[model samples]
Target: MKLNTNKAVLKPGMTLIELTIVILVLITLISVLFIGAKAYKEGADNATCILNQEQVQKAVRSHQNMNAKNDTESFPHDEVFGATGIISEPTEPTEPDNLYAGMQDDVYPVVGTAYISCTTTNGNGPHAPASTEGW
Candidate 1:
């Protein structure tokens, strides 16, 4: 008796529909993963921004402590303006890449006022100068 390799090898274990279904499932899974990953990245960026704001706050406190004549007083508003040594230069994580949006940028900040009187653009970009209030 001859071997029946041809009989079994020629048999199609999966139909065209089965192959198509498997491909579709894989595509769906990949798309979902990409979306989930994108969201995770966004969350991470926001968290980083919050932490940076906190660091700026600490730096400001340090400056105040070093310069305050009395413990009850804080750094004068004029002294705080245009000072760079106390804190690192703030920058945004995304777009514009500069600290300010533009030469004539106009934004209003409320959340991160305590540290630097600046907030991320639309609460998404990095904290920057919104007004000359905090320092």
Candidate 2:
């Protein structure tokens, strides 16, 4: 077979503007993703905060209700809202150490807003009911 040498071989390459546009597009996409991630994280934290507040409120209400049933008025101790026991899976900035802003006035998590705000009279936190046979 005979080959023709009249045609020129060519290779396609990106021009400066084309490459710049690609880079800009990539940057925009990355920024959008980062923004979405930030928003999602904030939303997640907010939800967690709400759940913690609800749990603490529930524990407090239960304690109060039980006491009321027995013709007594008492609340769980502060220790109930701190580490070693009551609270669990606390939000990002608020550790178990600072779960309470005050004892019954207005409980605000150190990290986020306690939107629902715990009902008055010191008491506290979150954790699944569990027990162990160990000292």
Candidate 3:
């Protein structure tokens, strides 16, 4: 009988090409997931900023109600709400210690028509209107 010794067998380990492909796919998937998560975080941050601005608007209206008779001509810069009160300046230079401290800086402009300003780290001024009128 002729010797029948030759046989094909599958390898136990992945081939280099197969391993490379798997690594590439994993990298692509991870990148996509990371980008999606980052976008979600940014959107959440923007929503928080808007909520904060609305609170500031409420404080302004309260101040306006208190000083209706006075010819104040402009919203109080230093003491409409109060010198130490919330809503004194827009965009506190530093991160606030608490929510109230943060609101303290959401002040309306003393001069020309003031609106809720939504700004990024950079100095771009895009305003978001308040939920109610005269914000």
Candidate 4:
């Protein structure tokens, strides 16, 4: 019965080919994960930018209603941001972190009840929704 005990021995470490294959597989998986994460982050940023635009629009309407302003009248950046208690500090759509880019930092004028649009011209990042002219 003990005759076949030493017939085969298990190796402690993987061979070079096995190691290479494993490394390759790991690299592929990691790259896929990174790509998926990037897409997900971009989608999230776009959604957030859209939501911010909607909120700003609502604030503008509220301000206009409260003050009896008309759609033809445009308001300053600070009207909705500081004067009203809606958004204390608006987020600027900057580069790298912001997929919806090209927002001015100091100014976010409420104009004619239209949605706030991102002026990014790169054609790579998120764009404003065509239906409402904003993200």
Candidate 5:
């Protein structure tokens, strides 16, 4: 009587093709996550820029209220209101340049007139201009 011991008949798990497919799926998921994170960061930066603008606007209003009698000629420039040093001073001039230039360039124009311009840095990208309209 001979005993049967043929273990080779059993099939193995997970073929190379299946493993490759799983790896590809994982890579795709990671790519999507990275893209989402980047978008979120940009949005947050935009919000922050807007908030800064609002603060400057409020300060301008306060200044105006304090000197309403001379409102017509009481336009605050960089020197008076320290526009250059509002949030942070820009390396370049914070004049009427590209919108994002001020933020990225590290400049902030005066915020006394009806309209003011604020800019963002290159970190925000071309879409995110360094300058913006203020009240």
Candidate 6:
């Protein structure tokens, strides 16, 4: 009978510390991915908000031209909003507690040559051209 002892042969699986490290790494990667996704979503939301503002601006311009209203004149919010109007309801900003979203009713079209500026001032910030901005 021959007994063979080999110290070179080791367990194939990772050690406890190695496993913990891998888990931590995976967690880190997952967190990073989540952060990136969140940022991307915010950016996309911002863009959509901007486009909505532009659409509303164009609609307001159309309304003004059709009704012969001047920029200094304040138009009714319902004039260009709704399905029957030039454009449907403009989408609000996705960010929480957005000033623009809250002040949709108070917004009017006379700001800075009817540029439609939002007063959010938050991180997602200033979703200008709010639905009421050009109304």
Best by lDDT: 6
Ranking by lDDT: 6, 4, 3, 1, 5, 2
Best by TM-score: 6
Question: TM-scores for all candidates?
Answer: 0.58, 0.56, 0.58, 0.66, 0.55, 0.68
Which of 1 and 4 is the better model by lDDT?
Answer: 4
- lDDT tens readout by residue for model 1, 1-135: 877665545655898999999999999999999988887776665665555555655555566567644333434443433464655555655442655222121122233354433345443455433333443
Candidate 1 at 66: error in angstroms? 0.7
TM-score of 4: 0.66
Off by over 4 Å in 5: 1-12, 69-116, 121-135
What is candidate 4's local distance difference test score?
0.58
Error of model 5, residue 106, in angstroms: 16
lDDT score at residue 90, model 3, on the 0-100 scale: 45
Model 5 per-residue lDDT tens digits across residues 46-111 = 665555555555555555556553444445354224545333332222233433222322222344
* Model 6 lDDT tens row, 5-29: 7667776998999999999999999
Of candidates 5 and 3, the better by lDDT:
3
Instruction: Give per-residue CA lDDT, model 4, range 3-57, as digits (tens).
Output: 6656587779989999999999999999999988877766666666566666766
Q: Which window of ten consecutive residues has the lowest lDDT sum in model 2?
A: 126-135
lDDT of each: 0.52, 0.47, 0.55, 0.58, 0.50, 0.63
**Candidate 1 least-lDDT 10 residues:** 100-109
Clashes of each: 0, 0, 2, 0, 19, 2
The C-alpha RMSD of each candidate to the native structure, in angstroms, is: 7.6, 11.1, 6.0, 5.7, 7.1, 4.9
Which pairs in model 1 have colliding backbones? none
Candidate 3: where is the Cα deviation over 4 Å?
1-11, 69-72, 80-83, 87-114, 121-135
